[model samples]
Target: MQEQSDNKQPLFYEIIGPAVLKERIPLYEVIGTLREYMNIIDRSYLTLTGKDRLSKKEREKYKIIAYEFNPGSLHIDLAIELYEIVQLVFPFMMPAGATGLWDLTKSSYNFVKTVAKLRAGGEDPVIQEDNSIQSYIIGDNNKIMVNPSISINSDKIEESVQKIGSFISPGAVEQVALKDMEEDGISITEEEKRLFNPETTISEDTETIVVKIYRLDIESKKGKLYILEGMEPKDIPFQIIGDQAIGPYIDALKADQLKVNILREMAASLTGKPYLKRVLLVGFPGIKPNQGKLF
Candidate 1:
């Protein structure tokens, strides 16, 4: 691998299997796998920066540059760069460039490693009293701190895991590892792919809760809800069920608070937190349905 600066370390991805034995992998597999890998890094960066979305200019600020491709089972080295954004401390003060690229880089690597461990049925990493998840997977016993609550895009992270799993489904690639410059990283084998499948359970009883609709697709009859009051308020994906016309509940989308009875379906995770799945909306309190507009 090429030598990088002190603050920079080339991230390597090692794909191992019979297909790569000859130092060649299918073009489609390489493209698809690399695409998802970039997505993982992008999402992790967003989480660490505490941003919901990156602007067009900001997207260009963060990038993963591929530098070298080696033999020995198709090893690829990548470097991440985050450009400095200059901001003036005061109107009368000179502009100062702010950069956390080094910290963000290390945290991003630790984030991917933690995700891999979670997918392999590992326990949730220990969260410190300050709410940062500390991991010791980097070179020479380096500790990386990741704050779980900053702005975790769990759905995006899970999607990346599923996509990576699909790429391995064809059996060409038996396993993949995300490693640092020294090749210290986590591996996800074919056998452990099944662990990424979410464990879902449906509740037979109907329950009432207050929630706020974050997004709703009228045609797909699918949406997301943010629980306002309950055990722990969180965003959960929900699909309308039982042929109830969604037209009546269009107002729910604009409402600040909604009281609804629903049948909850939850997906269990190794982290002990059950993800909310399909929610059957049984009743909407205080909203009058327009009979004439029923679809």
Candidate 2:
């Protein structure tokens, strides 16, 4: 079990929380929560020095979502595990359970190679990245994404809404109380320190970021599956009908119209918002090369 020494994975995480708070998750939030979960699983003084080993339970508790440099695409596979994700974003009781949905839900967060890029220099524009709903959060100031993935209810989930509901009011009061201590200079115990660590706000320049996706038109060219002189050709998955038909697998993939429209609407909505100060079309993984000739 080697120590987690920081691999490079840039990510922008949005967690829709209870009482309707949709926010881009910072790296510190991930670190702070992971620190709490790690300490709970195993931690002595040696743990602080980066010599700690993760146990089986600890490994299952966190999911590492790193950005992959797929040659021509900047896209996530988009299969999300709700529970494990919550522990990283909000390592509290009943992650993704009824109360957990309110605790944290990951929705449409951008993945990058590094967080420092989000903190880039120069007159960078910011994107608020918010969709507001009335009376949902902060007296009509709720600026979060639409119904989050974690918010969907299911019998398959393993948490009691009752338990989470019980904690919300008390938790809010406690947070407000602790916030007051910032001015008074109160000391937090070691136990409270991990779970209650406050993240300092970053510069306003980095507050908002915009990502623009472009649609591309590709020309289908004649592709040949050439084999070596001494080698045998592997069995093809589909029958080749002249140079026109590629394979059944290729034919099986049809453009998802609903999803395409939804994505376009999302990009358009984020184009101008009060919160985000910058916008960049960093990667567009959804853009794929068309194998079929234009009709």
Q: Write the per-residue lDDT of candidate 1 for residues 1-295, one digit (tens) a residue.
A: 5455532445777787777765466667777777877776666566556565667877677667788888768888877655544221211121112223323433444464454455344333332212433322222223334344212334345556667766675447888766666655445566445555556787866677898986665644666677797435755667666557677568888889878877787766656666554576766656543333322
| Residue pairs clashing, model 1 | none
Encode model 2's per-residue lDDT on 130-215: one tens digit a residue.
Answer: 22321112122322222222212110111121122122232221211010111221112232222122122222121111211111
- Least lDDT summed over 10 consecutive residues: which range in candidate 2? 260-269
Superposition error at 176 for model 2 (Å): 32
Residue 213 local lDDT, model 1: 82
lDDT of 2 at 65: 40
For model 2 the local lDDT of residue 136 reads 15
Q: Give the range where candidate 1 is weakest over 10 consecutive residues by summed lDDT.
A: 87-96
